[model samples]
Structures are given as C-alpha cells and as structure tokens.
Target: MSVTKGLVKVIKLEELKPQIGKEVQVLDQTIAIFRLTNDEVRAVSNRCPHKNGPLAEGIVSGEFVFCPLHDWKISLTTGEVQKPDNGCITTYETAVIDGYVYIGEPIQHEKHDPSR
Candidate 1:
C-alpha cells in the first residue's frame, strides 16, 4: 500500500497480459488495467458508467473497451463513452516502474457540455 508521488503500486508488468484487463484495487478504488498489443498500459474505472458493467470483463478493442453488459464503448484514454451513448467513466494514471505497475489519482477530465 505504498504511494509515491500519488502513485500506488498495483501489479507487475509481466503479470498483465497483452490485450487483457487486470483488475486491481488502489486506495479502495477498483480499477481495470489494460496492456495493449503495442505494450502500452492504461487504467480505467472497473465499472462502466452504464449499467455498472464490469469493464474488466468486457472486450478490448484498440483504446476502447465494450462494456460486457450492453456493449457501451468506452475510451481508456479519455474515459468518454462513444457516440450514441451519454456518460463518462473515471480514468486513472498508470506507470510502469522496474517491472511493477503503479497507479495514480483519477484524472479529472473536462465535464461534458450540451451547449456544443
């Protein structure tokens, strides 16, 4: 439960398989970590904003994940739900250090504006 610069240790690099989601608890917040096929790591809220679906159990496609409950496409980078959907999920910062993964505080994204 060590936190360095607001980042807490989560999991090992090797333990997270490519194109697979790994669920981890950091600061009592459940997050889903994904290792892309290109070796990039991303962290997002484990539960989807829609239907409270388990995002970790969803399918990964590119930088988006389809909610297992209703296929709501969510962006791992921006935490925004795709078009036709109206919602947002929390995104977290992730870092890999010495083969271990660390997670930072939830990223504060800009609120959606309907005036657009």
Candidate 2:
C-alpha cells in the first residue's frame, strides 16, 4: 500500500472487482471497499450497525450492501441504512489515484440517523 500525506493507499484499483467488497485496514479502522457496477469506488466502515456484522463479507447490490449477519441493506454511498431497518455507518472519502485506491477521512456528516 502506498502512503501519501493525507491519503492511505489501501489497494489497487484493478484489484477491486465490481459489485464485490474488499476488506482493508486503514490506521486503526477496518474498512470495506467496493467497486460498484458503474466503477464507482466507495469505502465504509466494515461493521454493520445492526449486530456489528462484518460488512466486507456482505453482498453488494447496486449501491447497497446486504449485511451478511442479518440482511441489513446499507447504502455504500451515503452510508444510510435502507428502510425497514434504520441506522447509518461511517463512510470514508475514497479516490483512485495512479491506479491505486486511496482512502481519506470519514465523511463529515451525522453517522446515525435518529429520525429513521
């Protein structure tokens, strides 16, 4: 992995398959990186809000991931847990630089949706 001043290279862009999640370590956090069918790369906390499920092992559908533990559908983009279940996870900023996947800090937003 390559390291820049503010970005941490976690994996290669080619190493991430579309619609699949890859587990990676950045600093002290476990992150789940996904390449969407549209080739959008997203990074989020690897644990599901509902039961602390390992999201990296979850299934990816569109922009959402179905938590492997209890089938909680979460939005990889906004980190919003879809309805029927309500919660949110930490979403990190990601970039593809020089064919490498780099992750930045957590997105500046409220992680938990109490209104849900």
Leading candidate by lDDT: 2
lDDT of 1 by residue, 24-82 (tens): 88877889999998888999989988789989888999999999999999999999999
> Residue 68 in candidate 2 has what lDDT?
99
CA lDDT of 75 in candidate 1? 93
Off by over 4 Å in 2: 110-116
How many residue pairs in model 1 have overlapping backbones? 0
The residue-level lDDT of candidate 2 at 48 comes to: 97
Model 2 steric clash pairs: none
Assess candidate 2 and give its TM-score to the true structure.
Answer: 0.91
Segments in model 1 whose C-alpha atoms lie over 4 Å from true places = 112-115
Count of backbone clashes, every candidate in sequence: 0, 0
Provide the TM-score for each candidate, comma-separated.
0.93, 0.91
**Which ten residues in a row are the worst by lDDT in model 2?**
107-116
